[model samples]
Target: MAKNQRRSVTVTLLYVFFIINQALTDGPRFVEPIPNVTVPLGRDANLPCVVENLGTYKVAWIHIDRQMILTIHRHVISRIPRFSVSHDNAKTWLLHVNNVHKEDRGYYMCQVNTNPMISQVGYLQVVVPPNIIDSLSTPSSVAVRENQNVSLTCKAEGFPTPKIMWRRGDSQEITVRKRKVAVYEGEHLNLTRISRTEMGVYLCIATNGVPPSVSKRVVVDVEFPPMIWVPNQLVGAPAGTDVSLDCHTEAHPKAISYWVRDNVMLLPTKKYGADLTENSYMAHMKLTVRNLQATDFGNYRCISKNSLGETEGSIRLYEIPMPTTISRPTEVRSQLHKENLAKRNVSKISQEERVKSKMMSSYDSDEINSHREIENRHESGNGYHTPSSPQLSGCISITRWTFPQFAAVILNCFFYHCRV
Candidate 1:
């Protein structure tokens, strides 16, 4: 009886030892540690849940935030196409997310279905690259006058709020807050008292330690008052000839140009012409004078006006005299002789002198004899002269004979001179 009882105790001890050894060797336990995962946007992510001695107890993955079940063992229970499941030898259970987005970042729970569910949680951190928002940002190109203030803004969105940096696109130094800096860090860029050198393209970069940084190109246009330049300030042209005047101008906000003569606006007419052409920020003005006259010679101003200011460039128009030819001396002598003859014919006779001369006395016989002698000499030289009487005749007879004969002879001589 004692032998039998010892045998039963040994058997019981062996059975208890066998049971303890089985319990130590066979049970589901996590073999690999679940670690926190970090992934960039638009990339694939993997969450590994590994087990050892995992028998029929299936492994399941659940999203903690929404309490949504993602997978059970190797089968995906989630309706989303991006969520998938895979395992190797019932040991490694992987939850795969293809093309992960910002919303995919959260805590994922890996649970084992035992008598009471056992679970381990790991956090998924999704990092996103920078993206620039166009609507909220300022204009891509802006125009501001010199010596004025201007502000630029950059807006961006990302997983982590992106930081904005301002830099010159041409690699030049930038002015910020009245100080010159190579690279400025801020969402708002303020420039005070802008200058001509500050006109260029600016780059606004947005970054948050993510791959593929984004940038925007912004152009800065610095405007100023209209400035005029004329190559020839003094212009000369001959009368009855065409003349053209030109003036070049540079300005922003575009300037309107016209020609002004002596402060009077010159319009396009049959004798005057005006033309204007524009290229970028420059304007070319031309005023053409056809059939130029003496009155057209004066100071001409090219006036340019804009929203900023107005300016003028002046040009002088001078008249060139017409050349004349010299005449012969014979022509001048003939002209003088014709003028003397006209003057002699238009002279009036004096009535007092005629009456006194007609009543001659006998005491003047010597003078009368001298006159008769001169008359005889003239008659001997040419047949055109007539001889006079030596003695004085009656007043009525002398007046009648001399007056009629003298008047007829004078009329014949005047006609003969004009025909010659």
Candidate 2:
């Protein structure tokens, strides 16, 4: 009976002690549900695990997908330097990741060892920003010719494949398929029938949900044949004066320009000067002529030649005569009258000589003398008087008189006179 009572008392006391201990002890219970976390690449991340009644129980962190232990209590088990453990008293445990990477993304579990292991899982998501891949993208500078087709490609890499867009560096709208598009969306950009206006810097932009969009610069060069223009095609300069001729041109690959005159190339000399200046694709050519002369009056051609082609513009030089004074009206009239009178007299003498030469063979000298006397009297009234001479009277009479009857009567008198 004593042994039974002792056994029964010890059992009762042991039961009471077990009940007391049970009332004092508590199993690990989560203070709140574990929440999912997100972090950007190259940043830090914290996975929190809060528990109550965690006395005498150790907290562990594990990578669930990798089936690897990361932290036990306050010590980190992973060899990776970025992995660590932190705690706030006995109720809170945190798994810290420094400089998070894409590989650190996935489920992480917080587990406690007890009668049966208790665990709560949370996910860590890492996002990577966009970045341009220079090696695969188009070159920084590209050269092509006008009216030719050109294509450019832009490449980028990111956690999520990046979207590429093309725009003008000046922020102007881009031209695609003859239509103006605010922004071109594609990895490849093609330009057709390119012209000098299309030559400039282009921008390739890459972006996604991540922050800090990236961009690259590409330059487009459009080459073409040389084209020449002259502001003044016909320039004039006076003798002994200085003159300048200007020629403007547009070309690619820098055309060789010069001045030529009368199929001969002109060089800079004391009398001639030439200069060339360049502004982008346009070139200004100037030719100066000093001490201009009559020989300088001609056509001058400004020639520009390049591998693509050649062109020329012409300027003409001319001589301007100096002004002269006019003569008085009276002097001009007197000179004109004298010239007219002399012509009339010469005509009369020539006609008279022709008649006399023919008639001299037939007519007698006495008859010719009487004819001359009558003509002298008629001519004396008209401001023309001839001196009389007996020997030359017949010849002079024939030249002065035109009537036959008067000449006959005069001939009778002359015959009588001759006989006497």
Candidate 3:
């Protein structure tokens, strides 16, 4: 009996020793392989650390130099808002620092713990301040046609919200004119929309409002100041007839209302009477081209421009009673017409009639061509053949030109119109 008891005790002792050896050799598993990181002076940063099979052992974070223990499991042991450490799903641990300061630049350590075993430690780093050496000065001046509204702006950038103030170049002292200048951002110093009268050498002051104010001088030039607006067409008339392209503009102290031909202005005269309207921005000059010839093909930008500045916009005009074969010209004439449009010297009423006639004619051509194309395709079996393959499992019919590319274009046009 004594010998049997001795054997049993020996076996039990061996089994316990084996288990202890395995536990000592195989410690907790490390999840993330990372080096200690260094961060900037004033920025946000995160340090990552993780351990697996972390069920029993608690985790700890300690700042080396500070000797301050930062975290214990999910509980952040630091009172400062700048310090926080959290373990998500018991997998990885993170330390987040906010709005870092220069003094905050230092090393941090991540430590893991388990019963009956030594702790594991990791490191982190932080860096601060940035290079500040660059020039900041620029505002381009431009000539604008008189009697038009203009907007000018100044832009600058820096660390720690740079102060931005605009001063008229003509003024000896940099004064903030309430209506003329207002700060878009107190920090970066951005100004939006200054009028032509506000154009001149202006100073941009960037200071934390501290001792030495850093100022970048900029000159804002208002360019080509012209005033133009959409014109209303003349009294009712039937569709599909001759049409005129009409536009109007005026300038301060009145500028010549002319059609911009390759950047030059054409005045209405004998062949075309000038349709003029007077306004503070418009020069009371309108153009009406009679007989509206193809030679007049191009854009007509109503230019109410003088020596001060010039500005213009485009109005689309289409051909009336267009030929069936040329229905889809691939490109619309309205935009292209702006580049080399004819501005004959003509009255407004006639110009209006001309435009009406052209539009009606184009619409009529579109309808007839669409009907004819459908009929022609239907008459030919090959042209109107429907896909019979199961791969194309959908119903298709005649009388409609449906294809992927055409469908995309239609969708795009629909969206564009919606936006407009």
Candidate 4:
């Protein structure tokens, strides 16, 4: 009798302990953060919810959007890769799903164990195929000086993979494309020994079974053979206030730009300059010369070309004048323009420059003062001059631009100045 009484007492004590533990801080329960979620086709996704005062209340995951119910997880839930439960800060819960199928697209619910409380809803959206890119861009469009390394790429992103093709405008003197025996990524069309004939519009086509195929045009430009330009530049720049250079082209078969110093491509970072407008052929290409150094001096050009022609313009970037006082930053940019404007007139470049003259006119300044101002302020330490003039607005209208798109630019000929 005594032994039985002691056993009964021990059982009662254990039961009391269990009740106390359950009644602790598991006060109220709630879920938060997401009310909706978006997912792409053939990709993994995660849905999260939380439970507060999680003592007495347990968390459960459920499908709230589906016509038929789907339970993802429970306190004593199943453990599978397609679905897994997790906790954060020992409070909230989450469900992750891999290889999301089409039918798996719907709303989910997160509920906690409580009285008349504890429920949250989340929606999932599955993105279909045939997405179009708004527009295209490239690194830089330079008139290659005389002779230098010409590296360029065509970058595009869409639902379907894009196919790139190169062609010329005026003449078809392009380097004979070696019939390929193998497939290569971007590297197949190498212009290591590029000339004027290797310039044109490199078209990028994105296609899927859906309606019309989407495409992006990239213009390539080669110039000057590859030489030099002269200007003062700050070698090093601060984190937030870094002055940079920009290159744009209105040519087909886009141009490739790089940041070369001591015969090397310089990576743009906190201090060093960078090759801006990357992987774009037909549009604008820009490079930011960072952490300016005296050695970064010499000829810097916007080299660009296509199968029909090649062109380059030199802009020499020298070292910045060290700070003599604390001023509000400064930059000096300068441009050299003349009435002659080279209509293929230079004896050495008569045949070539003439064909390129119309091409160069797009880059030439009708308001020579404005371009000169851009160049003058560029070299001095007076700080960067962001063009905020109403004349040069970036408001993009839906209507298509024929020559601007074909030329790789839309020179803002605001009626104010009216330069033909």
Candidate 5:
């Protein structure tokens, strides 16, 4: 019973010692400083504050910018629904900002209700994506006349101040300030003396190193009168052949293209066919004439008309004479050989005639003398003449014959007379 009494007294002494120590060090003091937080807009943010020895002392959060208390202990003081506070039950306090907005970005204070009223400050950063302001920006579409100056404007709003750039939607180059560039780094794009070639969609891009970069499209329309270019102004084709005449036209608001012949509109038919191909602002006009006749050779007009003006191009269709091919010597040689074969089988020729016949058979078909002799034979009677006759026989001229040919003729005559 005495030992049990001693043990109880010792436990009472240790409890008293612990209570005295708690009374000496029982005050809320920050153990870890608050850390700055950065979060995107519409996201939650948590600012932590750690303290030690907090014994019944109230912990509070304050908005340094507004100089207002956000929370006290576990009760929220701010009426804003998005502001709240929590703790780890052991000295760590958290300030919660739900669905943070731009106004929430500022310095936040983690405070403690002590004799000295200790506090620490942390910053809250809220970032926002780029957004284009259409009210202050250029319109969706802009119309201008040819050779006129034009300007495009862009406006945007975002955190960190968005940077604006200009570019062409078609990925083509832009002429600005007497220079050409793929991208123009400015809020305004200025064009001087704008032509049809410079008309297209212009894009205004805004970014701030954040997600969801945005852009706006502005269309630039340039109006112009109708103009035409004739690829084949003077087309030549032979009779009974096919020919095509072409004309290229450029205009705005689309253009009507057609072909006119002798003040009459030419329609699609078996002999005359008209066709048109169109691009954005350019058109190709073609007229086809099948089985060209003598009457088809004339001037044809390609006409293009638009809301601005009308233009026409003239093309002259002329006849190109077809090439004439002369018959080859082989055909003439074949005819001569056929006639010589008939003469040899039908009647017997004299020795002189035989010599002449052999020479004629071996003659080069290219020589005109052979053809002339054969023609003379057909004109004369029996192609022969007697000694008393004044006319020469239908044979190769003796003056034109070679020495070998003359000797052969002489020998043949001599032998023939000897035999007689």
Candidate 6:
């Protein structure tokens, strides 16, 4: 019985030794291949290297591009502050790169210290957002004269080589080659023969496939001298009346505008007031002359001045006589013609007959009574008055009236009495 037990124990010992030898010869093996990693710039990245059956073996991480070892086992070997190493369950080794940069992009290898030195490589892609280079790009503000050529340039840097676009800051369309477009794509935006309409803020945008694109504002100022436009060169107003004269001007650099009369600058006062309204490059200037007198009538000028130059527009102010109750000869004739037209029926009376009949009817109503009251004192025995009489001696009765009305009455009477 003792001999049999000894043999059985020896067999058990051999089986145990065989198992230990097999475990030792197995070495380390990759459980899964390392997967490629993509991380944005300034972010952390974790590279996983899973292993199984590892016995007395150490895992390592290497930068294949630089041929530098980054980590070994649970300890970090790279001098870079962002490099770190960690493992879970002694099987999954993780290599950490914090705050990744463009220079950190390349191939990374997860290696195991084995008889044959097994390793697996993965690509670490670091993507960068767009960044504008101010020193090499257009300035924040640029000034150019009108009808001059100008160019705006933009420069950018990124991992994917950023694209550039130019557009107005006000969200308005840009004029390119005489064609209006909502957006322009190019590093350089050239404008030939620029005008005041193009003076405003412009946007320089740089973008790539990466998130958080960048942009800059460039102010394009168009400068020009003062130019005046006069709406009315001649203005007439009667005495004791108020009048307003206006002048429009366009200029850059914000021109100073004022009103001038006889080389004297007009100020704001009770008798005279001056006003100026401005809108960017355009200004509206007004001069109000209150209770105008004879002395206030003269040539007045609206003057505008800027750093570029000066310009002036003139207006002539003249006095008109005060109105009276008496109408002029032309006015009387116009009235007579209007009355004749009003008395016309749809049948349309003849012009001569209408004129004679209208004048007689008006005389009967407005002059007949006055003529009768004075007829006795001015009547002579021959039923006619002398030439000096106030009542005109004509076939039609005439009374106190303007010379035009009296002459028209006599002419119509002659035409009616002598009709063929």
Candidate order by lDDT, decreasing, is 6, 5, 2, 1, 3, 4
TM-score on alpha carbons, each prediction? 0.57, 0.66, 0.27, 0.26, 0.72, 0.71
The candidate with the higher lDDT, 1 or 6, is 6
Number of backbone clashes in candidate 1: 0
Q: Name the better of 3 and 5 by TM-score.
A: 5
Candidate whose lDDT is highest: 6
* Regions of candidate 4 where Cα sits further than 4 Å from its true position: 1-26, 67-81, 131-420
Please give the lDDT score for candidate 5: 0.85
Residue-wise lDDT of candidate 1 within 1-420, one digit each (tens)? 999999999999999999989977777888877899999998999999988767778899999987899999878899999999888765788899999988889999999998677789999999989999999897899999889999999999987789999999889999877788999999999999998678889999999988789999999888988999999999988899899999999887778889998778999999789998897678899999999888889999999988989999999999877666778889999999999987766553355445434433322443455457657867788443444442332111122224434444333334334221
* Candidate 2 lDDT score relative to the true structure: 0.85
Compose the digit string of candidate 3's lDDT tens values, residues 313-356. 56555454544555445465665565444443345657867865
Per-prediction backbone clash count = 0, 1, 55, 97, 0, 0
lDDT values of the candidates?
Answer: 0.83, 0.85, 0.55, 0.52, 0.85, 0.86
| Number of colliding residue pairs in model 4 | 97
Regions more than 4 Å wrong, model 2 = 1-25, 209-211, 262-275, 321-420
Q: On a 0 to 100 scale, what is the lDDT of residue 282 in model 1?
A: 81
TM-score: which is higher, 1 or 4?
A: 1
| Candidate 4 global lDDT | 0.52
lDDT of each residue in 12-119, candidate 2, tens digit only: 999999988985786888888778988889999999999888888899999987888998999889899899998878688989999998889999999999889999
Query: Measured by TM-score, how close is model 3 to the native structure?
Result: 0.27
